[model samples]
Target: MQPCDLTSTGGATIASRFYEPPGRPRAAVVIGGAMGVKQDYYAAFAQWLAAQGYLVASFDYRGMGDSRHGPLRELRADLFDWAADFDTVIAATLLRGGGAPLYLIGHSLGAQLPGLLTHRDRVAGMVSVAAGSGYWRDNAPQLKRMVLYFWHVLVPVATKLFGYFPGRRLRKVGDLPVGVVLQWRKWCLNPRYHVGAEGTPVREKFEGARFPLVALSITDDELMTERGTHVLVDCYANAPRRVERIAPADVHARRIGHFGFFREQFQTSLWQRTVLLLQGFQPSQETAA
Candidate 1:
């Protein structure tokens, strides 16, 4: 693992790790989770990518992990910030000393970030593990929906009311900035605003229209529903998109949730499947396309 840095759109220094195989590399970028997630979270997946003969670059967003941090009250942690950070990482690392075809693999929010960049075509292909199209339709059981709704509403209100939301107690939602909270709310509440022609400017920008795309979903993802993964498939304009479902039993002991799919025991299977997909193993319908 090699340490590296890239400048964010906000002019902050972004810290990252690059894993190169023993031989010349087949380049790939691996993006992990949302705010508060560290690059170390995907370390196993990076190693797997390296083992597959690909140079993997994984980074933390500015203000997260070892990257530069600003006043929590002042930073606007929006999805746009993620998109810009991804673009910066690509420019500084993957495209810096160009090698083999570039491929992108991201999980959860990381999956969403790649779709927003302007250079999707430059990439050889894309792999989205537990990817979401922003619609949380499968978040059923009215009580659960209410809980998520309350966090979506109250967290942002709390952040604006008091410079930072009391994050230590709530962990997930509270740690984010008001802008980021609002952006997520806008995407989740309105399915039409999440992807494809009906998506927001950010979603439209990242739409995988021309690239070969792969979408993978775990059966028991607590944070994202199967429908969220379906949204990704339906929204992509790519004619050759591939969708994969990893059974819960296959990843049981690993506790492969939305975040764990790119970590631990699931890493091997995920990487192997991704390598096969990238090597032209398309679903029957997409085979002729």
Candidate 2:
């Protein structure tokens, strides 16, 4: 792993790391992380992909993790800024790849936001892991009520009390700027998530995505329901998509919850499956353009 910070839109710094393959890479990949999850959280996965003869890149969005500046309250950023940060990483990876094909491996909110990127057309395809719309109404049965409580009570109260969400201290979603917290709260409350909450403009942006996407939904995911996953992926109406729902038993696991897919123990089973998708995946007939 090598440190390689990037200059994002508006000249801000995005903390990043690069993993070089042992031999000449056949392709390159960018591992976009879930919201509030640091780039470091993806270090193992990135290294594993690099070993598969692919250059890999991972980074922290501005105002989170290693990219975070001073106080959280003072950092002003919203979804657009986060999208631009993702674009910065993509632009850099394309340059480093030296004409090799570039693929995206996105987790959770990372998968949801790539449609907002202007450079998205440059991507060959994407593997969306645990991707979903965070609508409280469509959340997993076990998590819906708690999600309602978070939207109705916690988000407003906490963001107001601290001028930002103290998610790191609360051990919830991780520390977030007030703008991101409030904006995400709106999306979670809406039936169609961000597309509905933000309207036509956002919908058009998602429709602009032209590559193929394979969405992997874990049955035991505590935060995402099957309906929610479909709803979120449908936002990218123009992209050829194949949504695959996997059960824990299929992978011989007791539980493969929302975050367990990256635990490294499943490297041989889950991670290897991911590498195959990155290489040989094809869109199913129903979703083919």
Candidate 3:
């Protein structure tokens, strides 16, 4: 693993890590992480992909992890800024790919934002895990009330007082920049979430994503129910998309929640299946473009 930095939009530097495979690579992969999650969380997965003959790149978005160079309260960023950060990572991954096919393994917010990137065409295919519209109302019954409580009561008060969300201290979510937390809150409140909340241009951009996408949702994911997953995948209306809802029993596991897919324990079951998808193994779940 090699530490690196890439320039994002507005001249900000994104902290990144690269994993190189032992010989001629079969393909290159860019692993995009979920919100408030650091790049290190995906380190094991990147190394596994590298061992599978893939060149892997993973990074922390600005205002998070190693990329958070300054005070979070002073950081000026929004959803678009995150999209640009993905674009930067995509470009770097494409370069490292060296004419090999490039693929993206996006988790949660990681999968949701790539549609907004202009450089998305650089990717040949995508594997989205636990991707979903974060609308609080669509949250699973067990989590809905808590989600509403956080968004309605805590989010506003905390962000206003701190100028950013102190999620780490609260143990609610990871610490988030004020703009990101606020913008995400707005999206989650809207019925159409990403589409209706982001406005027409972004909606069009989402539909314009015409690449192949394999979206995987876990039945046990409390944060992203089946409906929430489809709400997100449906935005890429023009893509040749496949939706697979996997249960914990499918992999002989006790549970695989929104974040469980990344646990090293699934290295053989879930992760290997993802490797096949990245290798261009097409399943029958695709909808025609």
Q: How many clashing residue pairs, candidate 1?
A: 2
Please give the CA lDDT of all the candidate structures. Answer: 0.66, 0.88, 0.88
- Which lDDT tens digits does candidate 2 get at residues 199-278? 99999999999878999999999988788889988998999998999899988999999998988888998999998887
Record all residue pairs in model 1 with backbone atoms less than 3 Å apart, i.e. clashing.
115-206, 116-206
Q: Pairing residues by index, what is the TM-score of model 1? A: 0.84
The residue-level lDDT of candidate 3 at 88 comes to 90
Candidate 2: stretches off by over 4 Å: 281-289
What is the TM-score of candidate 2? 0.95
Q: Which consecutive 10 residues in model 3 have the weakest lDDT in total?
A: 280-289
Clashes of each: 2, 0, 0
Among residues 3 or more apart in sequence or in different chains, the pairs in candidate 3 whose N, CA or C atoms overlap within 3 Å are none
Candidate 3 local lDDT, residue 251? 96
Error of 3 at 77 (Å): 0.7
- After the best TM-score superposition of candidate 3, give how far the Cα of residue 210 lies from its true spot, in angstroms: 0.7
Cα error, candidate 1, residue 109 (Å)? 0.8
TM values, all candidates: 0.84, 0.95, 0.95
* lDDT of model 1 at position 248: 62
What lDDT would candidate 2 get against the real structure? 0.88
